[model samples]
Target: MSTLARWLLALFGWKVIYVPPPAPKAVLIFYPHTSNWDFFIGILTRSVVRLPARYAAKDTLFRWPFGWIFAKLGGVPVNRRERTGLVNQLAEEFKRHESFYLVITPEGTRRATSSIKSGFYRLTMLAGVPLGCAFIDYSRREIGVLGYLNLTGNQAEDLTNIVKLYAGRRGKHPTQEGRLVFAAESARSGD
Candidate 1:
């Protein structure tokens, strides 16, 4: 898998910049998720690093003829409209596995937004795992898990640290870069 990933990355001109955390359990959150291409690139990078991570996507993505492929690739279908306790469910997954990495595109969509969803933060805290800040810096043509940090239970302070990790990284669509704030945070602040 790594060989194929390397070959494909070389063919497409991308550099692998993976730096996974030592901990087996983590919530790997990808920032500036501005393009659908992040999914494919992320999959390739995961293969290159041989990281086993599961990710949640809208339920629609898990439907139809090609849904099996997505599921086979570790995709979890999620219903945004439903009031399911996904965070708790996923936390249980962590407890069930000795090693688990839940990759989350907190923006929840490729479109730009003022803030990201809070599920990633909640999941990390609930599961008692580190948070990995992954990136796909299009400007540098580099992609992979970049940094990991233990949350201090202070949302504001923790967000600052996460932002620092991605200071200079630019997404494929710079204009669509999402903010470091969480949806609930911004909403409470009336942003």
Candidate 2:
């Protein structure tokens, strides 16, 4: 699998800068998710790095004949309609596991958005896990973890540091890249 991933990535002029996760249990953020291609690129990178990470998706995506395929690929069903205590439930799941990497795309969409959703940040903080800053830079044809941050409960300062890690990184569609600011940040500041 690793060899295949390497060949596929290098065949397309992409390079993987393997930065191991800071902890066995973590919440990884992959930013600048502006294209459908990001999923394939992420899968390739995951295989190359041998990252045993699971991604969350809508509950409906986990049904039918193809559901097993998604499960095989590390998909965790998320009931977006009923998010009450979801974070805590996931946190408990994390505690039950010896190694778990919950990969989240905080932007939560492919279109340009003014602010990010706060679920990733909240889950990371509540779960007491490092937030791994994973990135895909179209400008550099690179994909890897930049670093891990143990976020302070202060959302603003913590978010500022996360944003800085992504400096100079470009998404496949640079114009559609989502901003790092969360809506909660604005609400707190009365913006």
Best by TM-score: 1
Off by over 4 Å in 2: 186-191
Model 2 has a clash total of: 0
By TM-score, how accurate is candidate 1?
A: 0.95
Clashing residue pairs for model 1: none
Q: What are the models' TM-scores?
A: 0.95, 0.92
Clash number for each model: 0, 0
Q: What shift in Å separates residue 108 of candidate 1 from its native position after superposition?
A: 0.7
Model 2: weakest 10-residue lDDT segment is 182-191
Q: Give the top-scoring candidate (lDDT).
A: 1
lDDT of 1 at 93: 93
Task: Summarize candidate 1's per-residue lDDT along 1-191 as a digit string, tens digits.
Answer: 88998899989999998786879999999877998899998899898889899888888887888899999999989898877999999999999999998888888888888898888988999999999999989999998877899999999999999989998999999989888887778888887
